[model samples]
Target: MLNFKNIAIRRGNRLLFSKASFIIHKGQKIGLTGANGVGKSSFFALLRGELHSDEGEFSMPPNLEIAHVAQETPALDCTAIDYVLDGDRELRQLQQQLAAAEQAQDGLKQAELHGNLDHIGGYTAQARASRLLNGLGFSTAQEIHPVSSFSGGWRMRLNLAQALMCRSDVLLLDEPTNHLDLDAVIWLQDWLGRYPGTLLLISHDRDFLDAITDHIVHIEQNNAEIYTGNYSDFERMRAEKLSQQQSAFEKQQREIAHIQSFVDRFKAKASKAKQAQSRIKSLERMEIIAQAHVDSPFNFRFPAPKKLPNPLLKIEDADIGYGDKVVIKNASLSITPGDRIGLLGPNGAGKSSLIKVLSGQMRQLNGELHSAESLNIGYFAQHQLEQLRLDESPLWHLQKLDKQASEKDLRNFLGGFDFRGDKVNDPIGPFSGGEKARLVLALLVYQNPNLLLLDEPTNHLDLEMRHALSVALQEYEGALVVVSHDRHLLRSVTDQLLLVANGKLQVFDGDLDDYRLWLAENKKTGDEPAPAAIASPAVRKDERKLEAKRRNTLKPFMDAVKKSEALVDKLQQQQIELESKLADPSLYQEENKESLKTLLAEKSRIDNALHQAEDNWMVAEENLQQAEKSCIN
Candidate 1:
């Protein structure tokens, strides 16, 4: 058990927590919730002794061992496994001590050493480490990879895994899922739900915290209060509290107003003056209920377009995907002006590939794809960094985009994307993934393209950022094509859906979730049901026409898919040529080094083209497979 008594914490001169107290017993999972900048992380740090409260007594079971995995990892350079293995410091030390003793004048010491090992449970360290690695999505092979070779997100995972391996009595985690993909996040949720130790997780992921935690401790207005139950439960409880507060406030307002009316009417009279004055004094002395900013502000707005699209892009029997693996085969899809199409599916569902095909950076096989005249596309690259130089500062980035653009413009634009004053000059190399994602969006917005092509736009943003982007995208008027798995984001910003399922591009006449559910119902194997009646009346007239189009375009489409496959083959050959040149270090050692530079440049270009081709190929394959699946096996 742990108890925080009269705990007070301040940020600079601002008091974050003043004389707050809370208690946690073993086997409890607590969620910390508040608005952004409510000092949730600070409170967690205080419990871990990472930060000292100005006035407080935090008492735990005496000398209790605690481990804190911060939201952002500390800089560490070592193999993933070695770092985890270091968690068993005591066990390693004991084993080394036993080995030294055995060498120091006695063979019988080996027998005695086993007893020491048993006492420390030294036999389980390796097993424990191995389990942790696998649980955290690391294999024996990954464990051996240099930590420096990993990205910042992966490094953070390693740090988290290390903390878990230490078997701390109490665990404090801040935004544990910030670096994790959805699958990894769910896995962590399950593990933490069953964890035996005292757990405190600070996060804004409502579903994540609600599913795993049993208690919610909220920090609001420099004060702390513990509520029994999950985040969802706390929300319900908090609502009730606020409602009650509102009632009291309303009652007080009525009482005060009634008194004021009486006072106003009777102040000039002699007898009633004393009573009205006393009422006024009572009203003045009463402390008002604090107006908590409990309601999250989701006032998202989309910018209305200056003009609508006449027609954005046209595709007829287009085969789009990566080199050799076509994803959308024999698919004819069109984008009109003012169409907000949500592209959605599972991870690796080829949504991004389809966007690339529409963008014209990629050519479709067996089909003539064309964009309308004077098309302006704002593409948010899924991999990002297409426009970013790792070595360049944010200001340098702006300069590269527009030489004539001033520093003031750069700061304002970057600031709009959540990058601030000094951060606008910071090197892109050290920026967080979320920061980079926002930067990409910022760049796109500044360009003011009529056609906005966003691929997984909400990947790294926090909830606040996600809401902000969703609001902005909602108001964007030009043809908007988005690829995302965020249901909330998709639901808010899009009404039409272009679903790339299996190998076919489906123009769903409804929203994303509806499309998903429709697919599940219709596409389930061995349970073919009659087609559901169409609820969306917009596409009713085109149902048969669309079916005919799907049928008529398929043959030429398949041919186009084949041609796209051929393109992938050519790109692969180009990759092979580049790889062969890169393999020879002697090529660079020679005189001009011009050939080497050219090869490197060629390789980079080919690699990018190949990536696009591969995406196209996927669509083709998916289309082919879907066609085959629609028929008998």
Candidate 2:
């Protein structure tokens, strides 16, 4: 167990926490939460022994193995799986020792080392690492890819995979789901739930916290308090406390006022002097209850558009992609005023590409895009944050949008986003990602566009800001198309779900929960985009005739493939049962000779059947592959 006893922690001269005591028992999954700068990360640092408490004690087992995701991944030529395998230092050491022992002709030592390797699952380490990679959304083909080949966000996932690869006693994850897509996030939530170690997670995603954590350690007002339930529970508990606090504060004010009135009226009279003195003494001894303040820093909203246009933007038979490459083809969509559409799909399935097409950032390779005569678009993408004028202040940025607006008015608007005083006029170069996001949102809102295209808008936003954005978006009069990993934001703001997959745009029939089920089913079948049946309008008749002919020709081969898959699955299950029986040591006892023989015979028979089944499946798969190739040709 980890214990913090009357601990006071300080960063620089600021006392972040004083007399904070909390016990994190073994195997307890706790979600650490607070506002952006309330020292949640510092508490993690303290746990890692990188920082000591300013006073009091912080204690845990000295031999405990703690694992955490690396903040930065160094670019290397190593394979991703090998990078993950490196997380198991003991396994690497054992392998190295065994190799050296074999080279030295130390037969006894080599045998001992091999036994140790088996004991530690060294042989299956690569398979375990591969599973971790697969669960994190890396394909089998990408597992062997060089670490440096992946983007920054992918590298962060790799780091998280590496951290999880360790055999740890305690795990510390800070915003582990920030870079992940919805599917990956779900996979990770399941994985962490099954972990056998103590977990301390720091995330702004409330849905994620609610799913994995059983306890919440909330840091607020320079104090860390432990709540006995998940994030939702903590919110409920805090809300009740705040409500009671408000009531108590009002009653206290009335009591103090009444006491003062009595003291003023009777202090000059001898008969009431003692009573007034007693009231004054009681007032001095009483504790003042402060009122609850739960105001969100964000108060801005999407102002009404200048012109309401029906069908604000339309894409007809569009193919969206980068130059010379098609990511999504045969796509079509219509955005009308007040339409709230949320795009959902697996990572790299062109959600962002479709957004770009709608926003007119990318020119379609084919078909046409139609926009209303009075169309106004406000687009927000992650890359657009880099496009901001770093040297300009928030006030200056807003002034550039409307030069006639007064500085006081601009400042007041910026204050709604928590950019007050000098922050409004200072260069935004030093601003954090969240601040930059807020500024971009502010700019987007100020534009009063009739159409909004947002991609991962809540990436760096806090829960309060996300809540504010959701509330604002719900009241927005303009059309919206948002692609986000935040499920709460998606569920709260969007009314329609559009699936961007298989190079086609289609309306999803169900909600976010259904989308998760769809993801699981697709992943089980190794179906990435579900193979779009795309054809141009000009070739519709011809394409239908060709498709019918191809289907007729491929039916037999497809049937054969399905039959073989079923046979393989059945044989595999029988083999697993046979193996389970053979694993029983009692079958080899003196009185069980007949049973032993029977089990061994059955195991051998099942093994032969499995081999034959696999062979047939391979042959059938080869025939299908050839048929597909011929049909394509």
| lDDT, residue 365, model 1 | 65
For residues 285-366, what per-residue lDDT tens digits would candidate 1 score against the true structure? 2222111222333222334445555677888887776777766677776788767677754334467677777776677766
Q: What TM-scores do the predictions have?
A: 0.56, 0.79
Displacement of residue 309 (Cα, Å) in model 2 is: 0.6
- Over 4 Å off, model 1: 70-78, 88-140, 241-298, 305-633
Q: What is the C-alpha RMSD of each candidate to the true structure, in Å?
A: 19.5, 13.3
- What is candidate 2's TM-score against the reference? 0.79
Q: For each candidate, how many residue pairs have backbone atoms clashing (under 3 Å)?
A: 36, 0
| Candidate 2 ranges with C-alpha deviation above 4 Å | 245-293, 528-633
